[model samples]
Target: MLIWRLQKRVLNFVHVPPPHCGVDIVDAIYKCLKECGLKNKVFTVSMDNASYNHSCLRFLREIFSRNRRLLCKGKLFHVRCCAHILNLLVQDGLGEIGHIIENVRESVKYINQYEARKQTFSKIVQQLQLGTKKLVIIDFPTRWNSTFQMLLCALKFKDVFPRFQGRKPNYDYLSTPEEWKNVEKVCEVLEVFNVVTNIIFDSDYPTSNFYLSEIYRVKEILNLKAMDESDFIRRMVGKMKGKFDKYWGECNLLMVVASVMDPRCKLRLAEMFFPKIYSEAETRNNIEQVRGDLYQLYMSM
Candidate 1:
C-alpha cells in the first residue's frame, strides 16, 4: 500500500502480508501513519472502490473518530477515488455493446499483429495521406480509457479499412459500417469521461476542488446523451447512469465543501447548479446542510 501526502508526494510504500483482508489493510495503514508521526493528522484516505478497501476505511474511521485532532469526526475521511469511479462508469457502458467492441478489437489486432498486414495498412495510410502517424491501437479489456483511445485511432483509419479489405480477401474481422458508427458514438460519449479522468488523475495538481464540477459535468453529459434518438446510445447511457447514480447520486460533503472553498467557485457554484440537480426543496435543504457542514469544518479547524 502506498500513502500520498497533500502535495501528491509519496509518503511511504508499506509491504503487508497477503490475503488482503480489511484487518490486514487497516493494520498496515495504522503502522505506516504511526511510524511517520501522522496518525492524528490524517483527514482523509483516498482509495479505489474495492470491498476490502471499503472495510479497511471503515475500520480506520472508527479509530479516527476518537482522535481530537481529526476533523469531520472521521465522517468524510474515506474518499472514493474519482478516477476509479470514472473507470467503472465507462466499463459499465462498454458492457452493453461488448460484441461490437470485440469485433473492433479483433480487427485492430489482425492488422497490427502481422508484419505484412501492418505494412499494408501503413501503405494505405501513406496513400490516403492521413494526418496522424499513429497506427491502430488495441486496448486492454480491463482499461476503458485505452478502449476509448483505440476506437479514436481506429476511427481515423475508417477510409483505409475498406481499401485494405479488398487486398485481403480473408479479412473477416473488419468492422461493418454500422459497427463503425456505433464506435463513433461510443467514442463521443467516452471522450467526456476520458477528459475528466485525466483532470482528476493529474499527479502534479490539486484536483479536489475540481472534482465537484467535473462530476457534475459528467452527469449532465450522460443525461443529455440519454435523451439521444439513437437506441444504442440511449441504452448505453441507461447503464452508465446506473453506475453514476450508485457512486455519485449523493454528493460527498467533503467534495462539496472543497468546491465551495475554491475562490473561483465558492457557494455561488452550488447555488447556480443545485436547482438543476435537485428539486427546489431539496436544493434549499442541501444549501443549508452544506452551510452547516462548512461552519462545522471551519470551527473544527
Candidate 2:
C-alpha cells in the first residue's frame, strides 16, 4: 500500500505459496517494491500484531539495511495497526461475556430464521411501540465489533424480548434480567472501542497525535472502570485492560515523537498524561526519551 497527499493505493497483492514464513513474506515484498521502482523509497510498514509479522519486519529491515536504504536506522519502520490492536482488546472483553453474547446471538437468529417468527416479533415490537426501525442484528462471531453492534441493537429491544419469549415458548435464549443488566454495562464499555475503531478506519491518514489522543481516551476509561464496584464490570474490564497493556503499555516511540511534533499537542499532552499512565520515574524518563527521539528525527531530516 502507498499513500501520498492523503491518497492511498494498493500497489500489489501477492500470494505466498504456503508456509508463510518471514523470509518468504519479505521476498514477496522486496520483489514488489523493486518492481514498482520503490525499493529505496520505502518508509514504514504497518501490519497487525502477529508473531509472523514481527519476524517479517526483522527480515525486511535487514534487507533494507544491507542496501543502506534504512531511515533513522529503521527505528520507525514498523507500525502495529491500531485498529487491529483495538479489535484484540474488544475480543478479550467479549471472551468474558461469551455466554451472554451467545444467548443474544441465538435469540436474534431465531427471530430472523423464519417468516412466522419475524412477523410474531414485529407485532410485539409494534404493540410495545418500541418505535425502533432497527431490527435485531445477527453478528459475525469472528468480529467482536459486530458483536458489539449486535448487543447495542439488542439493548433497544430488551423490553420486547421477554414478551416474545411468552408467545414463543420454544425460544430458550432470552437472557435473564441479571444477564441483561450485565449486557447493558458491557455495551457501555464496548461503545468506546467501537467508536475508536470506526474513527481509525474511516479517516484517511490520521496523524500520530490523532492516534495518541484516541488511545489515551481508551486508557483513561479502562483505568476508571477497573475500579468499578460491580464485580461483573470489573472482571470484564480486567480482561480488556490486559490486552490493552500488551499492545500499549510501552508507548510506541514513533507515535510519541509524532505526537510531540503535532502543533496542537507538542510536549504538553505527553507531559500531562504520562503521570497518569506511568510511574513518576517512568513518566519523567519517557518524556525525556520522546524529547531525545524527536530531536534525532528532526536532525536526521
Candidate 3:
C-alpha cells in the first residue's frame, strides 16, 4: 500500500506491528533490501511494544531481545506507535457516541457479508461510479477507512433498518437504499485519495503526515452539507469510518512520535521545515557552524 516506494527512496523508516507477520516480514524486507543493496544505505528497524521495552532498559536493550546480533551493529529505534494513540482517542469516543458507533458497525457487517448485496452494491457503484469498477474495500489495517465506512453503511441502511429492527442484514440480503448509501461512501474515499495523497508529499505544510489530510477528510465527511447528505456523505462516511482513522492515525502517529523522539528532529526537522537553512547559507565553510548553532538553539528550546 506504500504507493510511493518509500523504502526504495526513504533512507530512513519506522515499523509497528501487532504481529501480522511482523518480525518475519521485517526480516524478509531487510533481507530483500540487502539483496537489492539497500542494507548500508538506509536505516530501518522494527519498533517494539511496551512489553518489549519495560522488560528491558534503553532502546538498544529492548531491540537486542529480538535480534541479539543487533546489539553489536545495525541501527534501530524502539518507540511507541503514535497513531494508536489517536485510535484510543476514537475508541474512547464511542462512549460519547455509542449508539452511532454500534449502528455503524452493524451496517458494515451487512455490506461486507456476501456477493448479492455486494452485487446490488456494485450496481449502485456503477450508477454513481463516475467511471470505474475497481474500488478499494474498507480494510482492517486501514482502521480509519473502516471507521468511516461503518457509519456510512449504517446511514445508508437507515430506511430499511426499521424493517429489520434486529433481523440483521445477512450476506444474501438484497441491497437497500441505506446499503447503497454506504457503498457510495466508499466511492467518496476514492474521490479524496489524491488530495490526501498530496498532504504526504506536498512538503509545503506545517504538518505533512497523512492524518492531517485525514482530519480534514473526516471533517468533510462529518460536515458535508449536500442535500440528503444521508444519500451521499453519511453512507460514504459509514463505509470508511471503520479503520480509516484508526489505522492511518495509528501508523502515522508512530512516524511523527518517532521523528519527535529521535533527538535528531532538532537537526533534521530544521533542514526539512526550513529549506532556506540549507539554500541561503553564506558559505559552505559555515554550514557546520550554522547547523551546530541551530541545533543548540533547538536543544535549548
Candidate number with the higher lDDT (1 or 3): 1
After superposing candidate 3, which stretches have Cα over 4 Å from the reference? 1-5, 8-48, 54-79, 107-144, 163-301
Cα lDDT tens digits, model 2, 1-301, are: 7544576779898999987788889999999999999998878999997778889999988888888746556778998888888888888877887887889999999999998888888888899888884465789998988888888888889888899899999999999888898898888888888787776678667655667777888998899889987787888789989998888888678777777768788888888878888889989888887788777778877
Model 1 clash tally, residue pairs: 0
- lDDT of all predictions, in order shown? 0.84, 0.83, 0.42
Poorly placed runs, candidate 2 (over 4 Å): 1-4
lDDT of 3 by residue, 51-135 (tens): 5443332433434445533311322334334344334433443333344344445544565566554555545556554343322
Candidate 2 lands at a TM-score of: 0.94
Better of 1 and 2 by TM-score: 2
| Model 3 steric clash total | 38
Error of 1 at 81 (Å): 0.4
Candidate 1 stretches greater than 4 Å from native: 1-6
Candidate 1, 107-179: lDDT as tens digits = 8888888889998988888899997754768899999988988889899998888899999988887788988
Clashing pairs in 1: none
**True-structure lDDT of candidate 2:** 0.83
Model 3, 264: alpha-carbon shift in Å? Answer: 19
RMSD in angstroms, candidate 1?
3.6
| Ten residues in sequence with the least summed lDDT for candidate 1 | 2-11
